[model samples]
Target chain A: MTSLVADIGGTNTRVALAEGPGLMPDTVRRYRNADHADLTDVLTDYLREAGSPEIAGACAALAGPVRHGRGRLTNLDWTIEEAAIARVSGTPRVKLLNDLAAQGHALDQLAPEALVPVLDGPAQPGATRLVIGIGTGFNAAAVHALPGGLMVGEAEAGQVSLPVADAEALSLAQFLAGADGFAAVEEALSGRGLGRLYDWASAGAGRPGATDARAVMAALDTDPEALRAAETFVRLLGTVAGDLALQHLPYGGIYLIGGMARAVTPHAGPMGFAGTFRRKGRFSALMAEFRVSTVIDDFAALTGCASFLARTE
Target chain B: MTSLVADIGGTNTRVALAEGPGLMPDTVRRYRNADHADLTDVLTDYLREAGSPEIAGACAALAGPVRHGRGRLTNLDWTIEEAAIARVSGTPRVKLLNDLAAQGHALDQLAPEALVPVLDGPAQPGATRLVIGIGTGFNAAAVHALPGGLMVGEAEAGQVSLPVADAEALSLAQFLAGADGFAAVEEALSGRGLGRLYDWASAGAGRPGATDARAVMAALDTDPEALRAAETFVRLLGTVAGDLALQHLPYGGIYLIGGMARAVTPHAGPMGFAGTFRRKGRFSALMAEFRVSTVIDDFAALTGCASFLARTE
Candidate 1:
């Protein structure tokens, strides 16, 4: 029997039917969450749209913290639970995975072209891999291929205090900390992080700062301050990514996902992302052995849900 | 039949027989590694002394990296493989685990008294756990109790660049970096780390530095600089531990092991380790939810070997 897979995000929810790990792309449909009362309502409408297809199991990737098969959306007022999903989707065996875990499961399923290589390292077939997400927020997950199924490890990595190596970096961290007196990894690596970097760079360089991440990236080729911010952001991202690589040792590869990762991919190679990533003291040599890339697939979480159900079902 | 288990260190190796996860205390014997030619010799001698009891499975914990079921001891000139151990122990099933992974496996088997609670947090049953080793070297492992068995995630975390938050901490990182100009986590967290912190503190106060870590801890009672160093060491350890807790989200508990951990345990509470640990800005509340403790068992690795073989066999 086919399985139902859905990726529920803050603004939109995408649902699809899956035959094992492979999804029926033609059946894929996106619906604004704002139009629905809750996840149950969304799933009900989607099932009706799909002609009430029979399903054996279902899995949903939610943008929130999951505990005991239940998850709550960070930006949406919805408590998504496995029981509710199973009730609506007509399956008892269902799974609710956090967004980052979904990304981790999607690693092996992504097309080769969707993973744009920014740094060189061999991706060992069955080895563990790390998926780092840098969108409106930052988070990470580790994927392990076990005998039973693929196990994705959880992380609130975005909330960890930011790492600063030099005087300039410390100054930037201080600038980011401001009244809070603490700067987390997300404070300098997510979408708004670029704008924060620009603000700090401009403040230091005696220039006007960009209004947002879009404006700063738009001025990358024209404005010197924006260029400096992009370079600094890329290097900081590399350093943080490098530290994570060492912590996880994801021999398969390190997949960078989310809005900020794709936005910075074109300039990462030139801005010395790999250079800063490889600056881990005596472990610098070991750093060169990791493959870092950006995930370009917008529907990765959906694929992840399909893959999750495939392995479990 | 009993299982054979051993923990191989640089200077000493502890060998024992196990009935499932429980180690036979009387069977446990410590051997000076310099006396034995290799692991096979030690195992052979131990078996001879025990009247050659048959072992259905065998597991050994090695103080080095393990790749493809083979391991090389960092401080000893030895190569250990599953097949080699199988031949030596007369068991076809043999597993070689890195020392940190072994510690990760030892978590559940550890005596309640052995785990002295350094910080208060609920240890959720069947949840993920973290084992952080800061002995002569620093390293950590994340333990997941999956369906198949306990899967310990590998880490070369000690080799990562040191993180700094403030001016004083940045100065300490700089001083620790020295000529290498790059200070890793091990540089500021392991056994030698206390000495480096003391050196930095002493040098800052225009006082004499200690000969080693032992001297610094010994001076903690009367010397203000030594106390300062200890305070810094404990606080830094907490910060790193807190960061790791976020990275792994090890709701089960965070177990601290090794010589450094024990030496600093008495001072950890008084020195504000928990205070620094919960300093993760907006996520401080989340940090308070993690249980941090010290694993005091001297033969934890040996117990880990037994536990691993018990689950697999």
Candidate 2:
């Protein structure tokens, strides 16, 4: 049966049609939240443009919490209800999944080329896996293999207090906290967090910060400060990711996703991710059990939604 | 049907009999691990002393990882196998659980007086809960309500890197790291960690350190440095616990267990636990959703085994 799947993030929303467990590549379309008034409008416009093809079921994955058939985007002012989705799709078969959960479910469906290994280890077949996204915001999902289906545990880990061990990192956390006196993990790990790191570097060197995260990443090759900020971001990412690996015990693998992770993946090795990740006091050896990877598939969530619909049905 | 249950730790082993879902308090016996060779001897000794009561099943909970019906004590030289347990209890129905998992299962069975609420909030019944143990070593369990029973996820949380935010705390971590250059959460939050805190305090003030965890806690009333160490321990516990809360998203509550947690529970308020716990930047209000409590029951693991036997039967 033909199904509609949408991956909704804090920044933009991607809509696609799926046949069985496969996402239709050419049918995929992206929509900016700033242009669309609501998810319903985005869905309606997408459906209309695609010759208004009938969809048997619909699944929308959002970058936030989903409870009781509703999804509330964490970094956006959008609340999506299953009923609203049903009305727009002209079908009552609808489901809402946290974006991280979607990514988790799609892990198996992603092509080998879509994933790049950052840290190598044995990936257990059915062991629990973790999906971490660090783009517009940060979050994680623990994928558990259950009796009938997969159970994905959601976490607001990005909102947790920033962990600091190094002196300069501590200063950066303080700089980010400002008067708030509270620097969250998201403050140093997200896309905007990259900008904040760059700003911290500039300020430390007695200069006014002017560039955003995109500009900072683009200037990494030429700009020493940008390279330093990116290096710091990757190093801290390792520390945070290491803590998360312990928290979840996802021995299957740790999959990094979203824009910021991809942007920094190339620099992770040189920036000291492996060193910081495996530096646990007594459990240093245990860290080697978890393999780390970056998921470059943009339509992985769509694949997840399609797979979920097929599995549950 | 009668069942035998044992809660094995690094220091000691607790054996008890359960009739259906109730742990026979009078049948409970404590055995020092040093006195016995392994779990089989302890179980045999316990069964023989308990009048060799015929049991239908047996369950043993260990303070470490359990895999393929085998449990290994993390901080002890002990390995418990299900076959050995069956031979001791003379029952084929035997199961091995991680100590944290046992504690997780016991959360619902704890008596009113056995639990002391530290942070009050609406504990959503049947919602996800967490059990954190800070004793011989640190670990956690996530209690999930499944259709037929509970699914507990084990975590080696104590072995994770110690999170340090305060300047003095960072110094403490560095001190604790010593030449190893890695300070795990267990190194700062466990019973031994308390003693390390005292040692750090003494060294910082140029005083000779002379105390274990028990001696430090005993001197809390008169010794200013002892009091400060205890205070620092509580605050760090809060920070680590808070991180676990976000990692697990336990809306029901965070249950603190083991020796160190109970010892420092009284000073949690004045030591600034709640402040550090709830200081997650923009998610400060969201922190109010998690309730924290200290589990005081010593026989909770026995109850957990009994409950598991009954539920599975």
Candidate 3:
């Protein structure tokens, strides 16, 4: 019998079967959430396709709040419950974790090849590490390195107020405040945040047009507005990263997870990301000593789910 | 045998002998650090006054950075070493903690009466709590409530860039930036912070006077400048507290410790502290659910030291 681990997002789901901490290479499968009515339906389909093998235990990671043994998809009108998963998947034991929390567990299992270095500072063994996810949404977690094991402190950090510093940023803040009455960190850091920045810049340049984050990023080289928007996005990411580094003092390093990480990493080198991060007055020296990396492995969450189940067992 | 607990600050030191978590009320003694040469001298004097009873273990909380069983007092020309304390106090075991870390442990030990509630929300039993100390120096810690126990995460949060809003705050930020090249949270939140706010406001009103925090506070009723300074201090405290609450997501509550908490709490009610804290746009409703309290007990660090020693043992 093998443990089944799954990461369920709003539009897609990744399922895998493994016996231990690492995900089984060939046993991983992806499914469209819209093709199924609920998580149980998708789990059942995946099991049947895999010849309905006996399951020892199961762990599921979702991009939403997990409380009372249940989680509701942030974008989809669906809820996954531990009892329902256990009954459908034929497992007596079931575990659920926040997507970012699962990503936090993946820190130890990530291979050197799976990471792209942003800052190569001296990292201490068994030091606390911080993980930040800037995807369609924003969230963070601190993985405490203890003598016994790692303890992850999950957070809804995107809900925090936005930290603005310049005239352009102040204008964006005013625009956000005008629309929502308060500007949250997520308003300037998420996928939609990129789009917002693009629109704001385009409007300021007197060439206003509606566009998504991808379209804006694609036009970065050709469109001055897009380039400006991208720069602002990179700078804002740096600012938030600096704030989190201070709040957590994660001397071990900071790991940026999720899709948007790739976009943020290229701009976070010696005097780009790390520069804005370390410009915090007297503590700049201490902040300079923190390492930063982007998790390039797409299957990290699956490996993390497997690790979580094994640890719980 | 009783464990000896001592909280050593730059100017004062409180020593006590306790058997467990709670302090031995009458056994507590306060001493002037200036009267002694170093921590060893203070420890030796305290041991002698306490009749030199058989010592079990000792935990000392000093206002400094503790690493490798050594600590340096931030405001004093002294360093405390575990070996030195163990040698002088005749104790086989000695533990040293950062003053704020010691306070983090006191969260669980504080009595209901010792907490002056600023926000009364439904706190989760095993949720995370944040402790912020705004004394001579500023720092904070996040206490994660785990299934097994509480894990305290230490922070040098004062060094992070300050978060500012409003014209007055923007003006203050500009002033701080001109002076220090960067605006850190501690520049506007500590004891000297009150004085800085008063000075800035007075300068703006063309009634400039160089006054310390104590003098400004004493002139609050009759002096308009002092009143404005006091108001700004309270509002800044709230803003910082709110930012911290978001950063840590301390749904369990936010506890204000040290000498400055009492002064800040009186102005933290509906339209004061709590109001500013719950003004975070869309997350305002959620922020309203966080409990805020001022720790009134002066012996909290002593009690915390006792708790830490007991837990480790």
Residues B123-229 of candidate 1: C-alpha lDDT, one tens digit per residue: 89899999999888899899999877888999898887677889998998898884546778898898788888888888999987755888888998898988898
In candidate 2 chain B, where is summed lDDT lowest over 10 consecutive residues? B176-185
DockQ in order: 0.67, 0.67, 0.58
Q: Sort the predicted structures by lDDT, highest score first.
A: 1, 2, 3
Q: How well is candidate 2 docked (DockQ)?
A: 0.67
Of candidates 3 and 2, the better by lDDT: 2
Predicted complex 3: DockQ: 0.58
Q: Model 1 reproduces what portion of true contacts?
A: 0.73
Write model 2 residue lDDT over B1-313, tens digit each, in one string: 9999989888888999898889989988999999989999998888788789888999888888899998777678887899988887889999998878888888778889999888988899989999989887788888999887898986778877777676776788788884557778888788888888898888888997967898999998898889889988887887788888888889989999998888888888888889878877777788899999999998998899888888898
Candidate 1 lDDT, A186-244, residue by residue in tens = 98998789999999899998876656888989998888888988999999888889889
TM-score of each: 0.96, 0.97, 0.97
TM-score of chain B of each: 0.95, 0.96, 0.96
Instruction: Find the candidate with the highest lDDT and give its number.
Output: 1
Which residue runs of candidate 1 sit more than 4 Å off their true CA positions? A178-180, A208-210, B178-180, B208-210
